[model samples]
Target chain A: MKSAAIAPGDVTRYGLGLAAPLALVFAVFFIAPLAQLFYLSLHNDAVATVWGLGQYVKFLTDPFSLSVLGATLLLGAEVTLLCLVLGYPIAWLHQRAGHWLQTVIILIVLLPLLTSVVVRTFAWIVILGRQGIINSTLQSLGLISTPLRMLYTQGGLVVALAQVQMPLMVLPLITAIGRIDTNLADASASLGAGHWRTFFRVILPLSMPGIIAGCTLTYAAAITAFITQSLVGGGQMLFMPMYLYQQASTLQNWPFAAAISIIFLVAVLAIVALFSTLGRRARINGDAT
Target chain B: MMIDRRRLLTSALTLGAMHAFPGLSYADARPLVFATFTGSWEEAHKAVLVPAFRKASGDAPVVLDPMLSVDQIAKVNAAKSNPPIDVMLHDPGPALVAIGQDLVEPFPVENSAYYKDLIPEAQDPNGPAPFFQVVGLTYNPDTVKTPPTSWADLWNPDYKGRVGITNLNSTLGTGWLVEVARMHGGSEANVDAGFKALEALKPNLAAVAANPGALATLYQQGQIDISPGNFNAIQILKARGVPVEFVAPKEGAIAFKTTIHIVKNSPNKELAFKLIEAALSPEVQTTLTEPPYLIVPTNAKVAMTGEIAKVLAKDTDELKKKFVFQDWKTINQQRASWIEKFNRDIKI
Candidate 1:
């Protein structure tokens, strides 16, 4: 016997029941504040602020904001690329190797993530600082006359971002690649494709979706990250979050901070779109079978 | 029926929001969440300010949010309308900014006579917030054998690479700069020669420390020797047996002052008012000047002897003659440009 179809009125009632509470919570916490943010972004609320596009225009035109947006994109891309380059190797090794080897690899990647961000960043600082382990080692080994300036540099940012986001890249890639049939790779090899050819033509193409997904996640996280960037950059690293924090707090310019946030949101979405487009093209070229 | 539903929801919303807020009278009794820069204020609030506030309000505890000055400014700005910090202990610059932006309300003076207790510099014409000075040089005695007699000696070649200086952005840094300027026959009016002198000492300098305590700790472990830092930091460090020495240099030690202004749109105005009063009360100010950390007292009533320092210049008169303090407001106004130039000019 078939169950009776749900009535339109019942569906409406059910939808309203869920939507109303969600709308209420969002309205109170997220939406209302966001509405205020919109207002702030548009107008000066300082002297009983009236709505104008001055703040938005200011944010759009600001050189510092542009540089921050640029840096954010670059850092995000670097982190994602690093995750792809480094993560795939670890993930592949884990898949091929025995359970004990896989455990060791898993532990190694997860170790930094398991630690607090603050602790991890501090560890990096210690390793990268002038008087830190890296410098001391370099000095003891007679690598150079003076200590190398490694910390508070973009290179440092990439290293840290890569380390932090590597797990993000690895876990997903592993999940996707591990699920791929081992027989397909073997068959491709038997059909005379070299190991390198097999990796590029078969495995790499198959793992594109996972790679894209992982890269997108990493880029978003790395770009928006505040604490790691700030610590590593030494307050001089003028990232978007740092700039946003300063404008809102130091300058007492809420409108400016909101406007900057809007800019950040736009940039992050643009990056995700750019990468996802690449993923879409890859999906199209790869064929349904 | 539609009208009834809308009206019911509207009424419910209004009531719900209102219920979240305190009733008008007891609103003043709500806990005033306050913050001060970490260091001496930590001990002062924990050991003294908290217990007294608890005693006064019975249930309205002052939540202590400790922070660095820069971080404090950032956090307060983040939570302005709905401020997590109801009251903050800010230095002259931020206090000035707070007053300028109307972020803080004026203090309510119950008695005009009691207001006379503030030093000439502490008096502010515009707001209820007054200045607090932690005068005297903060240094580690164990690191320095002679215990630096003058500001000139801080630039000595022996103490190079072990000397800690304040960030050029802060009053403490400018204080060191101004003293060196006067020593090299320059005035606060022209800080060029002084900045040059400071730049000259840069090769020997350690990192520009964020707080006096950091400098003191480095100095305590014999990692650093000179930290021409804060007054209270020296006191707190000495109290903790860090072997830190506080004295006036011959060119006059720079006196750094910070003003405390009540926040304008505070949830606990009455309690905030009371806390300020109690903070400035004799009971509170005295503890800030106890043995080992015997800081100079602003209150005419709080007794501070000249015998506080155990070094080169033992007496207060001799100390005052040597380390003359500059006008803070004058220095604070021009700090942004000066610090920017200093950062560009100095290597460390």
Candidate 2:
């Protein structure tokens, strides 16, 4: 066989061949529909025959639309924060657990995702209802005279959404924490750094990519979660997805729905961007130190 | 340049939607897709209506695709060119929208046999209603000592935390708003009175379930004693061994007409018409109005002997007199806003 050095053009050709399928798939599935949604957003009617930014203008100007957007952001942020605060320790434990124990722990974390969201929401309703298990147990224990109203409350909805989204947060954190070189943590501890100090300085900083991934995924899912929010919040939550459904299906206003969808997409993208920028700045600051 | 881009994107999106719809290009003896309810309604159609339809149409095959009315309408809206749905079974609320959007083909009166026998209210320009879902007070007889007579009784302090109301997305929900509006001295033209009345009932309201299944759960669990629900739903619950009773309130109840419309550009228009005829047939109407489904038949000729006749509205004129029917086209225009206000105000 003749010895041949691969040229730059050959390498470029190989790379393009490797990327072609993915590029085609992305164009077919993602970019095309996204463009279509944007186009649909511009029109003032359902048929898409009418062409203008009237629907977008209306959505932007409507107080109801604005409030729904606010609620969506609030819910997404709250769920993401809750997941981070609760998931970190769980992920840390899973990272440190024995092989069999880690498998069991991972299964527990993923069990909720395996179950139907509707089923889970309904279970929450049963657990949190006035005459539910909690109330019954409390009453039996003589904790209070009156049954506490937990179902249909904002707090109750947060609990349900957080429960469903916890797995998403935990799995990413586990991956990030597992990837962390334990030797660095051991080095920090050997150098007389305490547990909390080593974790804050070494472990958490190393897990930034995972944190960002988990938060982005959880927040995005939480914002768009229609069934859990509607069932748990009892249609009183008025989140963006529910509002979009009302606009699209109930009112038969496809244009308004498209506008709201775009707004939701932009809001989510902005949050993700903000997180990425903050992470980058923090990493730069850490490098300087 | 921008206009061309817009047109191109628009065309691409429109083309994309053609793929979004379920496959309609199929070869069958009776190639038709009928969209209606799931569970018992679907079962009833399969066991009773489908066979009756086959016999009525000389053994033409029919396919029943079960979905909620809202979803069916959405499917139609998404695929305007050729919706996979050939026959749509929906409430008058969505039917009106379908008509306004020109998504439905007008009933072929020349093709229908029992179209004239249908009640005048059912004989809509959009489509004839095969059955009626009368919105009345449903209560567990075991829980409540007093039998509530009027819609205003929902506001009574004794029934506090016992009454159930549907959220604004449902037909019963909007109907409740309209009914309350009229009760509180507001007409269809202005439902400001409706919102106020609804807000007033907030304290008494035990649950604001979005669908029949949820409402039924509330009743089954004894979380609710009374609520405004449909006649069919109440009967279905009763059949399931729930101790429930239906009453057409003294102030009158809301009657939602469940219409069957033929989709425009459906390949099975002839078969669809034949199926509609079978649905409106006396035997089929009786089957629909009987035990499991318990829907009120719209066929004027369908003689109800044992149980259904006692529950059904007296006549089409009586239905008009007793229940408030709003122009759904007008109602739809404000539906999104009304739902928003409803969600905001009616905090259960």
Candidate 3:
């Protein structure tokens, strides 16, 4: 038998062939169910006997639904911003720390991810409860007369979500910041750029890709986090996931639930697309500089 | 008998496929799958009901697939012809939904030994209720001082920022809402009064818990002092030393029938019937009514004992007198709209 020469095109074809099984699985499992969901969303009623865009119309037309959508999107932004603010310092510290300290920082960053999300959220409940640590501490210190209501509040929810999703933010930032050349920052400093100026000009822009990546991961995770959202945010604080659950599971309104899912998917996709566009622009600007 | 590479690989793939998809190997004689509720219900059924079922059926192969009632409905609805679950347990609201959706088979009531034994409220042709989940005012006794005698106690300004509640996503929440509406002169069909009451309750509300489970957490954390709570849930908390006390208000505690139904087109229909029969039986019900479980029995013959007797009722007569059963058929009709309204209006 003659040995056949392998071309780059052949490698690509072989790669496609290897991906065929997974593609088939996705098509059958994920794509098929998603298609069914979309089809279900088109119906007017709960049973899905008649086909119409009534479900979408009902969601989009209703101010309540739109507000829920807005609140959910805003929640993701809040979480992302908090994660960025808190996580950037830790990621920076990780990069600058000694070998042992770097390992310690990484472990600390990753420790929350290791435990279950439910466990972490429950821990947050304990920490933010009426007679919880903060409340007791404040009361003992005579800081306040009444226990500050923290659990189930939006502010408390954001903080808990930020803590839970910190790893998702920090991991990407660490990798992105690590990718930046140390010599670039040193050269900027040598040129009489102050520490703050060096950071603002060199480090921040260079870390934009990481920031974008971290934000995207965190934003998606925080928004779609059903367990954390429900447990932390409470019932009255209706986020998209909880809203969708209330429709689908509680009311058994499949059509409406499907519509909510589709709308949420589209909204999240749009946000992710925006992030990618920003990342691309940042890259272009970085290259231009 | 030569194991060639292609043949070996093909055989290996076949074995792996069979392992991954066990239904391919045993589609005809799959064990009975009863989709009971998660947590305490799962524990009660596993300990008391399953044993009784096994004993009656001569140790028949059974699987306890614990899930929420709505989930069971969804699962069966998705696969009408070949349902994964043989049996399903539901709260009153989802029971109506399951029946309306045509996802469940009518209980063979005539053949059931305990169907006639069940109290009038528990007996349904569609699905016989094996258990009754009682909802009443639960309070932190240490903090509450005076035991609340009525639902109106929740509105008292004395307990400001110390009350908890769940949204309409749960059976407990919806049932409690209907009861609240009834207290405010609104029936099951109309809960506008309930909404008004909830609005009034905003001041006292410490945490509008996402679910009943979260309410328990609030009590444990001292986040809430008083709330409309499930009897069994409060018992579970009390057992764990949570200092929570359940009291049936003067208006009457809401009794939600925890209905059990055989799924449509279940392969193990006979076993499913046997299992449900076991669930409805007095012996199993009595055991479940005892300590740790504290599940209120629907079978009239089962002697009410322990915490259930003390907290809920002494017997079937008292139970009938004390427990207020709502027309869930009426409630289920506009439940979607009510939930939507709740989502819109309720904000702390």
Candidate 4:
């Protein structure tokens, strides 16, 4: 009935007009690059060979491939865990703080996120270096006479990644936490549930969606991250992307690199899909949207 | 609010960095890009090594993109026509691969006085390429409690978490493998025992460093105890006030050579050779051994060097007895197999 007053074709035209820009962008950046990569992976040197998936097979079977994949997954999981552990408190703090304090806390939370990955990674290098502030301070405090080895370890990589990815976790959880009414906490307190108990029983059940979203986002990012991992992990990290980088550049095996990348993508997608299924089930059980 | 510019400096220095890194440099300024891949090696070249080449030749410089030695040739090969490259400096490993692909034309300016009397390995046996570069260890005298004369000193307990290494896939890894094999236990030919020897020194590892600026900074700060740094890199390190010592191992590092060649499509073809000819000249090569760019010159007669420049003299007469030179012929023939084996063996 209302369709008589409205122009019928306008909806499709407007929807298409809005989507046109994004489609063009997708075609240009995503589709074009993928096609070029596929083309490259098929060729031996400059000339095209039969478009076979030989490159993928080479990368998959190589023993080094497993090490890199394991490393990437380890780093990704470490980053995600750190984000959830650290980011939750900061998100809660922001949600509960007074208006100006919350604004300031939010701004502080966003600062690392705003800075480029390279800048943050460089900062880590400077701070974690043997003569860097941490070592310098510890030495001055008479904590240790020598600078502890900190810069190029797995711990150093964790700190750098966690710092860079914290905001990704915090922002979403804050939004979810903010939506929870104080009435629920008040009600829980009246029923004799303590702060920690209420936090576990009341607040957490409500924030699961944000937690899931944040984990997914940060996990995905950490998996593909090359620049930060390279800088912060300091060649100690045997990451899959780094292996892919070596294959394309040093080994000159584009096909092999492509194959490894395909395997990685498949593995990552499978893991993410599996995680999301578990998250969806949890959401259903918790009665949270 | 009194904003202090000097306070900014104080804060930055306190924070352990002042300005952004001096933008990482490359060799040529022209369209001809040469990725050096060995990060510290590139930093040394751009900062200390290539400057002399530029000054002596007066040719427009090309960007010297530093890379991991293991991967530079692959990336270059990947970008053959739309090559982000025109010239590159590589050791025998990739040079073998490059030759297999016909990536180079015959290097024209090779009949130099120094090249004529090269220590066998410099001349490319399978092809017409000029031998140009060498690799070895550089140490800071202040950092090392006991200075090393051979590869065995690297496995010292004191150096646990002290030493740095370059890209594991490069000649640095291969050279270290070969040297340790010869000195420690294994034969000069097959390095099974050599690879195992390096395993003992694993704990003392600082970082498998690839970035030249990072290595230079570390060396300057005395963070590195014993690390793989090249001759030109050490020269650059010393100039930066890092108290460095050059260690031409009793068994000299298998003197890996980087052949300079002209590209088929290099626009500055005449300019390129003139620059090459100029670079190969005794005077230019002599000049290279001094001041900013402290390379061991390709010229035998030109013995000029800076006060800090360590002349890498081979016990030329005792090559068979002392050194384990890489047979270019053998390496060239088994090139692909060597690379595959290096991968399967090191599994990096």
Winning model by TM-score: 3
Report the CAPRI category for model 3: medium
Tell me the tens digit of each residue's lDDT in model 1 across B233-273: 66666667777777765555565555555677777777776
lDDT of 4 by residue, A121-144 (tens): 788877887777898999999999
Please identify model 1 stretches exceeding 4 Å from their true place.
A1-28, A44-51, A56-65, B1-29, B32-43, B54-87, B103-105, B108-114, B125-252, B263-271, B290-297, B303-348
Q: Which residue pairs in candidate 2 collide?
A: none
Q: Which residue window of length 10 is worst by lDDT in model 4 chain B?
A: B20-29
**Interface DockQ of candidate 3:** 0.70
**Highest-scoring model, lDDT:** 3
- lDDT (10s digit) by residue, model 3, range A1-289: 1244544656888899999999999999999999999999999998899999999999999998999999999999999999999999999988888999999998998899899999999999999999999999999999999999999999999999999999999999999998888899999999999999999888998899899999999999999999999998999999999988988888888999999999999999999999999988876787687
Of 1 and 3, the candidate ranking higher by TM-score? 3
- Residue B215's C-alpha lDDT in candidate 2? 78
Candidates 1 and 3: which is better by DockQ? 3
lDDT, residue A218, candidate 3? 97
The regions of model 3 sitting more than 4 angstroms off are A1-24, B1-27
**TM-scores, each model vs. reference:** 0.74, 0.87, 0.93, 0.75
* Alpha carbon lDDT at A66, candidate 2: 86
Instruction: Report the error of model 3 at residue B214, Å.
Output: 0.9
Cα shift from native, residue B39, model 3 (Å) = 1.1
Q: How far is candidate 4 from the true structure (C-alpha RMSD, Å)?
A: 12.7
